[model samples]
Target: MKLTTSKGARALVLVALVATVGACGLPRSGPNKREIFAGSVLKQGDAYVVTVNSRVTRATAVMPAFGFGSSFRNAGVVGSDTINAGDLLALTVFENVKDDPLLGNTGQRVSLLDQVQVDGQGYIFVPYAGKVKAAGQTPDGLRQILTKKLDSQTPDPQITVQRLAGDGQTVSVSGAVTGQGVYPIERPTRTLSTMLAKSGGIAIEPAVAIVRVTRGGQTGKVWLQDLYENPGLDIALRGGDQIVVERDQRAFTALGATGAQSLVPFESQTLSAIEAIAQVGGLATSLADPTGVFVFRNEPAEIANSVLGRKDLRGDQRMVYVLDLTQPTGMFEARDFLIRDGDTVYVTEAPFVQWTKTIGAITGTAGAADSLASVGSSGG
Candidate 1:
């Protein structure tokens, strides 16, 4: 009988051989890839250099809660506010004798009841208390003035002043909220966060929300989560304060060899490149090129010039920032560099990744040749 290897046995031997060859050809990163990745950075003249220290210290942000933003003020320690023009006041005046003509002579001792409007002139007309100054006075303050004014003229007058509405009483809660209403801004609801709570906290999660405060035509924004984390960001709101709770649209695209390659949210209003790396799930350990990390952004001409250490920077400048994670100090610099909205963080693939494909092709060809040789032997 002719000697012939069984098909199953031959198949097993071929698989084992391919496995061995595949393991041998698995790629290893060499010095050549590192040089090529870093060499491009060295060759670029227009690129800016943001050292780690600059990244941490150079970034700045304007604070919120109006009035140049006082963190201390936002923590809910505000003094009493005086009423202003266009405010509404409700007055209840009582006298011992209901027979008084000025009081309408109602049977009950509580005679005068009036809802007074504080006009643009900052005055409110009263029956016994004529043109009482309602503006620039607290409810208590106005009560004292009204009682004192009618003290001798009216019989044992008792005055009650309730502030119906403040001049700039309404606060606008818009964007991602359960209810968007023009709420009456009162004493307890004078804070940005307190007002948000009155309108039903937040419809969306604070982690992915931005709280924008606009007052007197000036606007400032803070991360909603940051406001929760740092109470100082939860500012005391002013009259006509517009609070917008928008879903965070600002994201940075993470590409290349990160753990997750996608658009990562800028959870915080201000993000450093180092922080962004964590958000994007860091580098892909097996395939990432440590020396080939990069951030791409457009820079203003002056800023580009200052960062690149050159005076030639001008007009519509864009830059690719190279970061070599292989270096001990490179990571520290990345921590300080501020990441703007729409930035691209790219981590290149190790050169070995490409080499593996090439080696894989050669191995596949070799395997085919051996299979052909086996078939010829079987035929013979």
Candidate 2:
């Protein structure tokens, strides 16, 4: 069949072709306002479409609570001055008898014993003083015990016990820190914050930094900032404790007509909807529909019930929260609305965008048809 080149026939064909394109639907970032409204629970879709309001903001304003529990908080600071098994002690014995010194040579009144390790059974052996319990005792306490033990062997023997920094009473600091090593628990580094400092402090941002402490079989985690803000969270360090500092792994997905589509990490302890939008450089100005900003999340049963005002919902519920920035209170509602990990913030394209795209398609088609008509007329 010969192709029609007449202007009248071409106009009719262009109208039909445009109609087909319109019926098939034009390209869009995501669902429009009407399509979103149609997907509400009241409609055929399973998602609950809620308009952002003060109530919805409060219902979803929950934040992650990262801190120590009662067990960790109740623990007292470890005594840095106290002696423990595996610790090295330096002992000095001073005797008044110069002629017959038991521990020292003749004319020598002082005897020094270096690197006296406390045994696993918490006992330390001294020459002529025998075995004495040293793990639970302080340096001064051990000295008094040694003085009494050696009084029978030496006349008025004075003893001094000094605790040395060793592997015992130490914590292993690792992960996101300026320095990662085994640090001794001293008077200044007996607590969580002080120990972190002794390791050259946290290497990550304080806002997103998490401090995890594992003592024995139990482990506790708290935000690095909270560790200082809340005194109770800064628990004392213990022997054989493992400390790790790391960044929060929570993030959300940005899709549709936002400035950029990617996984955005939580930059602060708490994130609001507006802040999240800003983190992605806000919406695409030319294509975004201010009235069609949506947040997609699968809320827990408890939060879903609170949001929908119905207790019948169980398990995770798919929810789409709509924000109309054109309204007077829309900006405020978005400001108060909190974003959670794994949420998807989507901004639909303006309704006019599809129409403009359709127009461009129609014009391009017309231009091609006119060129074909000109070529056919020339051939005839």
Candidate 3:
């Protein structure tokens, strides 16, 4: 009777646990493959599900273009010697007069005029020249004008004009650079690379740094490393240009059965799907289904149309792409496929994992029942 009662009690506990586990469902990182597929657009779901292949990889491999436009690329380097309004000129006049000099005393042969500011009208005031045009003229050009004007007053007047500091042709540099401030475009800092060097180089890693230049209403961007590798991408720096150096903010979320379920940043300018998985520590080996890998993103309408081979989709559409790593070309496809910003990389648990959980739960409950039955019998 005792043996039969113990067996019955264990069977009852096992049945109760099976029902409870079935009703409550096993804890999972995310939905299974079937649940994910059922949510596809073909099944009245919000997202469009597509299997990744060579065609799909090619269609979706496009990354954000980051190079200067024609206007920026074609822009010529500005001459540092050219003078403009808002520039401060330092002028020194050498008088050859013997007794009484018009601009200087007998002993004072050289008259130092410092901080001679150019006005908005592009003119500078000299002792005798009286509002001489300085803008659009180099230092030597301005010196000739000053000498010519003072020639009549004094026997021989030799004047020299030097640009002390320029406030007119300057570029403001900020963000992720060692030095951030407004810098004048001088001979050493006339181009993009030179300007970045003047600002103490980029503070972030060269592999992930982005340089953005905004001129007037238009903005152009380039990878910091690419700017050096490709000569064509190193554009000239114009006056009033705003240069910003920053770390690449693009990242993706690693969820489901990935080794690490967290946000992972792009290690390089362009990131592949396989590279992204590697960055997040790869898939959870014990629980992950090698065949059930997915990438979820809101793809643009054009890419979506191309990927699905359907023109009906308009605007940004939710998309879920599947990758069966068990296939021959699956690893190659993943290597070629690009992962965009805000994408979710997920790996579903193997089907057998849930069954294993069920078995474990049942055995645990049966063991507890056996222990209770043994205790009750001993007490009686």
As a TM-score, model 1 comes out at 0.66
Off by over 4 Å in 3: 1-4
lDDT of 1 by residue, 259-375 (tens): 787888877656877788888788888888877777777767766666666788677466667777667787777777777777888777787777777677667856775676577
Clashes of 2: 0
Q: Taking the tens digit of each residue's C-alpha lDDT, what string does model 3 give over 1-380? A: 77777667667766776688778877889899999999988999999999999999999987878998999999898888899888998999888866777777777888899999989889988876788999999999988888888898887888888998878789999999999999998888889999999999989899999999999999999999899999999888888999999899999999988879998999998898889989988888889998999999999999999998889888999999999988999999899899998999999999999999888887887777778777766654
Against the true structure, candidate 2 has what lDDT?
0.88
lDDT of 1: 0.70
As for lDDT, the candidate ahead, 2 or 3, is: 3
- The TM-score, computed over Cα atoms with residue i paired to residue i, of candidate 2 is 0.94
The deviation in Å at residue 6 for candidate 1 is 20
**Displacement of the residue 190 alpha carbon in candidate 3, Å:** 1.3
lDDT by residue (1-380, candidate 2, tens digit) is: 34444665567667777777778877777778888889888998899999989998988888887777777788788777799989999999999896979998999999999999999988999889789999989899999999888998888998888998655788999999999999988889989999999999989899999999988888889999888898777788888899999899999999888999999999998998899999999989889899888999999999999998999989999999999988999999999999999999999899888888988988887876676566666665
Worst 10 residues of 3 by lDDT: 371-380
**Clash pairs detected, candidate 2:** none
